[model samples]
Target: MTASTTRRTAATKSRIVAVGAIAVAGTMLLTGCGDQTNDGEAKETKAAAAPLADKLPQAIRDKGVIKVGSDIAYAPMEFMDANNQPAGVDIDLGKELGKVLGVEFKFENATFDQLVLGMNSGRHDIVMSSMTDTKERQQGASKDATGGADFVNYFKAGSAILTQKGNPKGIKNLDDLCGLTVAAQRGTANEDLLKTQQKKCGAKKIKEFISDQDSDSITQLQTKRADAVITDFPVALYNELEGGGGKLFEVVGDQIDAAPYGIAVSKKNPELRDAIKAAVQKIIDGGTYGEVLKKWKAESGAIETATVNAGK
Candidate 1:
């Protein structure tokens, strides 16, 4: 079967929030980690510091904290919980990374579009948001170039289509998006993909919103201003489960352009990059990695190893 076909099956079996009993079952499958307190499930026993901690930049070692820039609105990856504290798979990973590096992980919540700029400007040490590792981003070819941030891939994800719970428009895939209004976060690969597919879909209307927030796009769909929202697969799935209790929206298509999500560090900080990569692998081997993903109901996206600059 083709990748799309495989994705379709996966969506049907594991991710999509269908209507009626099927929707309840799909939501139940992932509810394992949803109700825990923000810090509850992510609180894993700390592992010994990895040797790479010694390789960290002196300034960082002295500071004893790795400042992370993230748009904390993507649920289950990085977002605020009931107590208004940052919590999610990425947040838990960052905490584990801190343990391995022998330092605290300090998150600096910023607009998604500002993350790269923040790193380049020295406002943040690393970005652990569920940022995709793409060729264009890794190359820093965009107008917002900050000397090309390097990435240490840690998870797998892809673009998926989300529509009203019942899929009123009969949307199935990109082919079905023709002439329809689609919403996606601005500056994200999802938006870029839609722009590229516009012509192929007979000039579909694409609406872009600030990357820091996904609610805007969801609002567009809910208000009938957009026929669908295209975003990271996990984000859409999580929203369907928690945002409206599986009643507001449903994933309609197979994931497309599957890619790795990476922890971004400035290219100037190769030492930090290598240190983080090693720390990540250490956690994966120590079992803490799986704990974090499982806590977020995102074990499906877990990676066995971490690779730097693996974008393609």
Candidate 2:
């Protein structure tokens, strides 16, 4: 359910533009009182009058954009559509956040494992991939020394088992993964889960073929390089419904370890983090949040209210 702390193989290959906060914290921010009806200036006026605009730190308000880091490959959460534009539940929800904050929530695609690292390095303002908000990530529980992030909890999801079509090898659940070769994205919660399950496998410890992206993991499953793929519930379901009309894969059992998906904001930018927390609540209260979930057929993961740092 979490993106791997993906490290880009080459720093220069990153698509992100360095978006450090607008260097000045003294910029005057507007809050719900600007207007311009002239055809030439209408757009500018509306943005200036945005209700939550002032909640952001003046540095970000002046910049007018929140850079987001995302893997852009998990369907129903984030993925490249047929049009090659970013499209999915997270993209739609990010648009909603942009409207309320009166700023652009710009998504910068990178490998799943490197997203949080990017955010910490000032390459992005936040991360909105379907990242599970576990305490470890919130604490940067790794060798990376950038401290970590605080999560604005939004949606909920769980882990699931995905196998090739026809339930080959009779794989039925996590227990069935024993003595089998499985594919998973490196540095993800799924990979950690696999390691946990491997201990139970004893002498038959499951072999793993880890990849930089889940799509590559799926390729492993497809080519018989791996027996199963561990992934989020929505991802498992999405591929079942749309992977050639369910011919490519199947979900074997019920989901496990349900957890919240969070928007990762650097601890250094608490104002932006709290602003986003409020904005997400606004969407849930107004009901647009539910509509986006339904649009992606992910209504099951919807929550009644937004919370902060609730991940276990």
Candidate 3:
């Protein structure tokens, strides 16, 4: 797998701010739970116990908080909001999962490159970044893998091509990129797909970036450094709708390589994995799942069931 860097400092700062705020909030929420007044007040203060709590590992139940590793740069999925708060589909879903597990979900921001490493190192209990569940990732075959991670698939996504508004280069599909310059985040399924497609169609110049920080690959397209950027369908659409102010980029072909985006867990933590799978299903059954997706305008990616290690 190719290694690349993400966006610049400003974006990184924003994510840090969001993670800090989330951490503070989680601490406060947990602290506030200990002081109950009267019987009525105690009842009101008490959070509904999760039926799945007994299923969680003893360590996690004792800790009362699940430390999550995430790359918060992916907007509409996981990103910083205007007030420097963590807000997005993944954040909301993780929070709901925490509630269902009767624990606080604390998000820690890291670069896309650091998440898997952090998870394997036990720096984080789980990973809620918008990571795609591919065979390579599931097998931990990348440069960063100490042990491969398992996935609890919760959302769906597909690869898409993004170009300048009106598609000046007239690129209609991946085939058209055969001899053109393309930009993609290194170590991603999209990059791998591009490489495979490039081989099949002769050769094309693929400009790989260190991270999918929007600034790098999108900048490449804006400056004509590359003819196109191949990324997740929702990401490309979100950039066009929100990031670019609706005037910078446009989606160029039907979404391809559609797959589920999974909540990654260490293969060593099957107990936690089963607990999360149940928690996600609870969220979906309770309708919180749909609400979160709708809030981010990502309802199209919502899956009916949360399955463990279901990635292809």
Candidate 4:
């Protein structure tokens, strides 16, 4: 959903094409992504020389590439830049981590809701979407709702409400949406928050206009289909600043549900999880993490240390 679901068709195709190129290079250069056959000696030698090569599982070590599933729509996290290339905090951090692991962190576009499920199904080696590390996800509460995986928490953020500029509805908080329509990305924490708010709305229950991506929700708000949109604080701020060249939207009220954003890794791949944890800590220590957040103006969500499933 990079650039939003409306942009999903073109952007996703661009990423797939970009990824296909990378995949092909991984094959041509690394001889089938480190096939391990005698013909792959050139790739093995180069890959084995990486700084953190010893930390990865032998199978992945040979591949020299980590398949990443990401929505790629949330700006400042993962998004396609004007150049139509993948760029953002998550993308930058993944690049640094890739250097340490001696593997190309090849991101593939997917709907935010499908990232974890796809990862669990073996479509990806990991998921680098801005996914929260909730307890239910750790225990695999639902096959599609939250993938069963270990989370390597890197950043923390809270959800916020985004309303159209000029305060048209005089909305200040969640309660204001009691009888209004709201938009949120399907399968996100924001969607859940809205549902919880609905119960309190009583007779004037909140009407929902859920979309596949946040941008679409923003579009709904722009078109007056929704009174407001709920999303991550950083995302709300980003849209408020960039949307309409900083004139289209504005953030209202305080944020809620502050929690760590984790990179999803299979529980079965403890080695990969631990390796990523270490790699992130190294990136933080090395100052690359700070640089990335600074570039995205997202230092507010920066975490002091990388941990596992630190979200409550």
* Model 4 alpha-carbon drift over 4 Å, by segment: 1-49, 143-147
On a 0 to 1 TM-score scale, where does candidate 3 land against the true structure? 0.81
Write the residue-wise lDDT of candidate 4 on 59-104 in tens digits: 8877878999999888878889899888888999999998888788
TM-score, predicted candidate 1 vs. hidden true structure: 0.80
Q: C-alpha displacement of 225 in model 4, angstroms?
A: 1.7
lDDT per residue for candidate 1 within 148-207, as digits (tens), equals 689999999998899998999999988777777888887788877887877575545444
Order of quality (TM-score): 4, 2, 3, 1
Worst 10 residues of 2 by lDDT: 17-26
Would you give me the overall lDDT of model 2?
A: 0.83
- Superposed Cα deviation of residue 182, candidate 1 (Å): 1.0
Q: What's the residue-level lDDT of 310 in candidate 1? A: 78
> TM-score for all predictions?
0.80, 0.84, 0.81, 0.84
Cα lDDT, model 2, residue 219? 79
Instruction: Please give, for residues 247-294, the per-residue lDDT of candidate 3 as tens digits.
Output: 888999899978988888899999998899999999999999999887
User: Looking at candidate 2, what is the lDDT of residue 38?
Assistant: 51
Q: How many residue pairs in model 4 have overlapping backbones?
A: 2
> Which ranges of candidate 1 are over 4 A from the true structure?
1-52, 203-212
Q: Judged by TM-score relative to the true structure, which candidate is superior, 2 or 3? A: 2
